[model samples]
Target: MRSSVPGTAKKFPLHPGHPERICWGCDKYCPASDMACGNGSSRTQHPAEIFGDDWFEPDPGADDAGAGREG
Candidate 1:
């Protein structure tokens, strides 16, 4: 059998396993299956998300690589 409290919101369990990750940019709660900005902080959120690889270090080589690959 199941149990419930009077007038309380229905409480349901998530999946078997999951992680609660919040999006620093949107301030929305994201699940494990979702993606979270690696460099989330008070300084910037979108910057880290838009530029994942270069978030740590602004590599000049990245720009040159893109320029060379362009048609």
Candidate 2:
């Protein structure tokens, strides 16, 4: 059965290293290179795997570094 709630898949970047292989269907992290959830029904896929390494790039001119903030 399809879920009525819109589900957002957790995105794992490859830059930091050792991106975990987690099941988007559930909360368990499957590291065995196999589907460990839903009896091989849901496929596990990372954001970088589908959209390339720069998939999660920051917004342009967003000023996220707190450039003018005082201590």
Work out the TM-score per prediction: 0.21, 0.39
RMSD of each: 16.1, 10.9
- Candidate 2: tens digits of C-alpha lDDT, residues 3-61: 35568444433453444455444546565367666547655666666676776887566
RMSD of 2: 10.9
Off by more than 4 A, model 1: 1-23, 27-56
Candidate 2: pairs in clash: none
Residues 10-66 of candidate 1 have per-residue lDDT tens digits of: 333332122233333343333434646443433233344455534657677776776
lDDT of each: 0.42, 0.57
lDDT of 1 at 27: 32
